[model samples]
Target: MPDFLIVHTVLVTGAEGQLGRQVIRKSADQEVEVVGLSRLDLDITDLAAVRKRIAEPVTVINCAAYTAVDRAETDADAAYSINETGAANLARACAEVGARLIHVSTDYVFSGTSERPYEPDDPTGPKTVYGASKLAGERAIAELAPTSTIVRTAWVYTGVGTDFVATMRRLEAERDVVRVVTDQVGSPTYAADLADGLLELAELAEAPLILHATNDGATSWYEFARAIFAEIGADPDRVQPTTSAEFVRPAPRPAYSVLSSRAWGAVGLTPLRGWREALHASLAG
Candidate 1:
């Protein structure tokens, strides 16, 4: 890290996550000192552990969340443990240290009924427990520490984890055909792009910054899967488009979770690439 460049310590939770890992790797080039902690190293749900960790003055990036949308319906308690209480703990800790917290939220915070993209200040009406918990997390973070940022993103995918893109790739390799829900519309965000946005937020000396960061364009899972197939040189026809009713899950997904980047721009930060461009880049990797 450079001495004159105002080097700061970054304490990143969920270090093994796709976005968290990307943040750690990319910070190297930017010369930012990072303290990446996995669940084993530090679990946010444990208040004692979190309080101890945040005693140091460091920029905190929380990427941890119970993200299994379907499972959350049956396991709301588990979801709330990490997403609600855990978030509050981290926020309070950040407040104690007088550090800026960059918390990653989700589009599920919205009901997804709007024809237009969701703004940062829009009213939240979560339809599922996962959504509700994530929204709680956002609120907790904001209320506990006014100097925190809540970044809502959607349709996230990366080389790691079992995301939509990876699932599509797996199905393409095995099945002759695949069924995807077309009713849900949202932008697919590359973890790498999101990581960059976090870095930008860390550099800013602002408080209570709520931003929506994702790939620019919107698409349904059907379209997203077809694009993934096209990139992988697989048969796009094999990926069949189905309605949400036909592909029922335990949790209810928002029909449209598209988020606007207007708030991110307010801070003079450019939005991420469009879904098409990001999809191509992730597939290439």
Candidate 2:
């Protein structure tokens, strides 16, 4: 790694988010200094605020995003403001201060029609406002900060947040049975694992401009729910599998949003552990 890649300070935006919190926690043992800023401290949509906050030569990991998938259908403007314009603001600020950016993205950029895992350079056909806004963010960062690394991950969950694992655990306690969508398939990435992968990329002198980082294997939401129940010593039999048609939401979900990890592997970093193993670790923590 080049001397420049030897990070001195890391500025993490969206510091209160699931992945952002993990990044902060994981970086404690590292030699570099880390500063985490929540939306209350720094709004990425405000260019002046972003510029003022990122005035130093530090690595900027943008975990901030408008993540309301279903609400984005009715609130496209709000989503675009944060996901697209906010990303552009950060990119521009990083370029001015000579800070490398690691922008977190989503797998929703793809249509999910591919039989195989989606690659970094695959054509994007976002099916929802949320997906389109996220894709716009990726484009803005790429165009404004050419040296930035864009990491696209999917099905991310953390123990602390209102994620899939938490939701399933709550429903299991309240209901007799839980119905999960079986038609949709994707890799479940623990926020902690994803955070570690982003930091690993931060340490590299050279990495792919675009990479897919997630847990090794893929599974449907139904399988994931069952695994979650098994992890908590609950009745896995209480988890029921159902198709997407049974419970429709405003935003269209991709049927297959699994992303390939070949790009991350090519950069000499191992992919994350399988979803089941990560889930167990997350629950145990």
Candidate 3:
């Protein structure tokens, strides 16, 4: 709790992404200075480049990733380069600089077979290349830089970025009925809330070994879409709940990968709100 708050520099990768940009906006209330970068500024897969970027002692929050779930089947090398290799590079550099590394990850690391929420210590059995790659990144960080905080979130959305919420909003304007997979269940995390949680964790003197940073309650994509429709004052009946088999993609998604924030709570961090409540706030914004 020392005054490390005085003009501390924060380096956020994938600044143009939904989560990164939210971190930028939310950090306005803090005393720390924030510098954000997209792939153009730093391709994290390059170890030398990452080392150079970490020359200054600053908090590094890596939000960069190849998130094309379906495309990952055909382009796994590219995904691994960005997700796995890039994470390794960043973790090594953070260790060199003694900086806290906050790496954003996904719930896809699990096989989605759990009846309850996955804990931080839960064994990861990824079903797709994208999931496997992200899980690899988590493992790399844990083995290489145990001081780093690996945040595994799920179904993230923001008003400005390309996410399910934005897609649903756009589709609602054109289609009378929209079908979403109901069997695949996870929490719909608001990027802004996740950003806040990261900043809080970053400023802390000690970061957790691992944490689940999603919104509290869980729901399938179908129920999530229905909630979105209702929040926007659209007809909930227009949102149809379907199974995953009907909407098959190139990558196999998890049937259920909701993550629990028990690890984060162990360190006394405030948990995020429930999905519906957070979604309402995002839509309003």
Candidate 4:
């Protein structure tokens, strides 16, 4: 390693999660020392637990979240406790310990009515309980840790996790056709790619307080499903396109979840590859 390479200790919350697992795996060859903590190991909702577990001089990567979109509608309190309050707890703990915080957020923070992609400073109008709670967490971290970095991504999928790519692959094996919503659009991000981006941000001397990091380009759910099928050597025609109204869920999805990466480029970091390339690499791996 170079003399300038500061090998900081990194504490990863939600270590068992898709993105967190990737972060841990990628850090194996890097200069950083990583300590992964699952929900069982550290209950971030408990402030004392956060402070006790995160007392070391480290960079904290908060991948823990209540990610069940539809379930959050009925379980609003549970979602808030984890997503909002838990985030605040981690922020406060990091501040006390003088650790840098990198909080992972979602594109759901926007209402998705904009014709273009959303900027980091765009006005937020979340449409669901999950989105609202995540936005609240972002606010809490911003207020508590002024130097913390908040990375908002969208349509994240991983090979091992129960994400869109895995779901489509499973459905392709099980059923003749898989119906996907055509109206909902966003950038699809592979977990490994996202992990790399976060680690890059961690090494920066100074980064934007808020940044958007996702695989480049945009596509609707229907298109994304078709690409996934094509990558797996399955019949793309079997994946059918339907509007959001046909399959109504408890949570309202944004019609457009695409986020702009201009801020990401402005900071002098190379943007991630396009969604199609990332999807192929993830499935192949």
RMSD to the hidden true structure, all candidates: 1.8, 2.2, 1.8, 1.8
Kindly give the stretch of ten consecutive residues in candidate 2 with the minimal lDDT sum: 1-10
Stronger candidate by lDDT (1 vs 2): 2
User: What overall lDDT goes with each candidate model?
Assistant: 0.89, 0.92, 0.90, 0.92
lDDT, candidate 3, residue 7? 80
Clash counts for the predictions, in order: 0, 0, 0, 0
Task: After the best TM-score superposition of candidate 3, give how far the Cα of residue 135 lies from its true spot, in angstroms.
Answer: 1.1
Candidate 4: the clashing residue pairs are none
Q: Model 2: number of clashes?
A: 0
**Tens digit of lDDT per residue, candidate 3, span 151-204?**
999988895546899888988999999999889889989999999999998888
Distance from true location, Cα of 176 in model 3, Å: 1.2
Q: Indicate the residue-level lDDT of 18 in model 3.
A: 80
User: Could you tell me the lDDT of residue 229 within candidate 4?
Assistant: 94
Stretches of candidate 4 above 4 Å error? 1-6
Cα RMSD for candidate 1? Answer: 1.8
Tell me the tens digit of each residue's lDDT in model 2 across 1-285.
565655488999999998999999999988878899999999999999999998976899999999999999999999999999999999999999898899999999999899999999999999999999999999998899989999999999996548999999989989999999999999999999999888888888767779999999999999999999999999899999899999899998999989999989988887899999999999998
Angstrom error at residue 55, model 3: 0.9
Error of 2 at 102 (Å): 0.2
